[model samples]
Structures are given as structure tokens and as C-alpha cells.
Target: MSVLSEYYAALERLKANKPIILPKGSAINNDTVAMEAGRKRGSIKKSRHAALIEAIEQAAQATGQNVPSPAQRIEQAKTKTKAVKSDYEQLKEDYEKLLEKVNSLLLENFELKQKRI
Candidate 1:
């Protein structure tokens, strides 16, 4: 089969919601599909292969088929970041208080040592 034939076959598998494996044996993703098809990844993003790009996007975007969209993943990351920041702020406050307590205890210890002398 020709390279073009393999490329089209990959697209058909994508349309059928099948996976495309890259040269490195990685599972197909938007970033890796062009590589899997022996094409430049820029072809998909820069409108070099308009129809193929659209088909890939539609296949990847189909919901209720259990596929996760890039947007969903980004939103999840943003939510997680917000939760982490909140937790970090609480930890920072606790750390500052602990430092102050330790400093006070050290001061008392120094005073006790001076009195003993």
C-alpha cells in the first residue's frame, strides 16, 4: 500500500473512534496523529490539511462516546490549581505560627540559662 493509502486508513480508523499508534508506539493523540500518519504535526494545526483536520477534530470531539476533550482536561487542571493554592495558604499561616512559637521558646530557654549563671 502507498503512504497515502496508509494515511487515509489511519483517518478512517480515527473516524471509527479507533486508536492510531505513533512510530514510537505511543497511543494516538491530537499531538501524535500526524506523526502516526507520517505527516508533519503542523499540517493539522496550520490548516495544511483542512478536511483531515476537521475530521480528526470531529472524531475526537464526539461526546457520549467516552472520549475526553482537551477543554475538559484544562478545566480540571485549573480547578486543581485553585484547590492547591487554598491549601498552600493555610499551610503557610500554620508555618508562620509555629516559627513564632519556636522563637518564643528559644528566648525563654536563653533567659533560664542566664539566670542559672
Candidate 2:
């Protein structure tokens, strides 16, 4: 139940790609890893947690696993979503322009038919 034990457990979970369970039964992630490990959020910069963080990074690198930390994954998802949303907006604008063009052509054709009648 010590902080060191929690830190080690978190490291193992990271290596195995398992979720780190917090004391309150919440799943651990990058943001919560330090807190779950009995340290402040910014404590990762501290000497002890810094070394642990380095170890985790090295382990992941050595294993050739691309398991992204939660923060990284969230940022990546946000970027992708933004791109998709932008594309969708552009398509919507194009569709509206095409519809307007079609309506204009239809109106002009109707006026010609009325004159012929």
C-alpha cells in the first residue's frame, strides 16, 4: 500500500498494457498515474518519480510496443476529429452551393416555358 508499491504496480500495468486501478477503483491513466502512485500530479518531475517515468518509457521502447499514454491518445483523437469535422463542413458548403446553382437553373427554365406558353 506504499507509494513505492503503487508506483511499481503502475509500471507493471503500463508494461502489460493493463489499466492501473486507483484506490477508488478508477482506472489509472497518464493523468492519474502520479496521483494513483501517491504523488502529486506534477511530481513526475521530482527525482524519484522522474526516474520511474524514465523506466516506464524505456520498458515500452524496449518492448517495441506503441501503447500510447492516455494523454497522447486523447490528443491524437482530438486532432483526427478536428480534421474530419473540417472536411464535413467543407462538404456541406459545397453541397449548398450546388443546390443553389441547380435552383437557379430550374427557375430560369421555368420562366422560358412560361414565355413559350
Candidate 3:
């Protein structure tokens, strides 16, 4: 089969969640479609296959396959990391406060025992 036909078939298979080569529930993007078509990951280049690329993009949009770009993924990761760090800091503060309270209670208990001796 021609490369274009192969890609289109792969796209259909992906849309139907029945790809032969890729895992089930694979996202409908250029790379997944290319790999499903038995081609390399970056085989569907815009310079070489502009129409195919456009078709894949349109299909992905139509099917609601909104895969994030690398930059978008990185930004999402950064936001998650920031939130995690903030939570960690809050936990650390709470731990320190608890530790201080425990120490104070221990000291008071020791003083009480000494007075009863």
C-alpha cells in the first residue's frame, strides 16, 4: 500500500481504538499514526506529507484527541511540581510545630515528676 493509504488506515484504526501495532486507546496523532502504519515515529513530516499531516490534525481535532505538545506537558508538570512543593512546605511547617509541642509537653511532665519525687 502507498504511504498515504497506510497512514489513513492507521488513523482509522486509531479512531476506532483497534490499532494492529500500537497499544489500544492510543492517541490519534501523527507519531502514533505513523508507528501504526509500520513507519518510524517521525515518518509523517509536514514537508514531505503536508496533506496527510493536515488530515491527521483535522481528524484528531474532530475526534477530540487533544494531545498536549511537549511544551504544554512541561508547563503542566511545572505547575504540578509547584503545587506539590507548596504542600510539602506546609506539611513541614506542621511537623515542626507538632514536634515543638511534643517537646514542651515532655519537659512539663519531667518537671512534674521531679516535684513529686
Highest-lDDT candidate:
3
TM-score of each: 0.48, 0.46, 0.58
- Number of clashing residue pairs in every model? 0, 0, 0
> In model 1, what lDDT does residue 58 have?
65
Q: Which model, 1 or 3, shows the larger TM-score?
A: 3
Each candidate's root-mean-square deviation in Å? Answer: 5.2, 7.4, 5.2
Clashing pairs in 2: none
Clashes (candidate 2): 0
Off by over 4 Å in 2: 1-65
TM-score winner between 2 and 3, please give it: 3
lDDT for residue 51 in candidate 3, whole number 0-100: 87
Candidate closest to the true structure, highest TM-score = 3
Q: lDDT (CA) for every model shown?
A: 0.65, 0.69, 0.91
Decide which is better by TM-score, 1 or 2: 1
Better of 1 and 3 by lDDT: 3
Scored against the true structure, residue 48 in model 3 reaches a CA lDDT of 90
Residue-wise lDDT of candidate 2 within 1-117, one digit each (tens)?
877677777667655656544543333334456665556765565565667666756766665746677899999999999999999999999999999999999999999999999
- Encode model 1's per-residue lDDT on 1-117: one tens digit a residue: 865466567766655556455433333344556666767765455345566556556655552233456899899899999999999999999999999999999999999999999
Flag regions of model 3 displaced more than 4 Å. Answer: 67-117
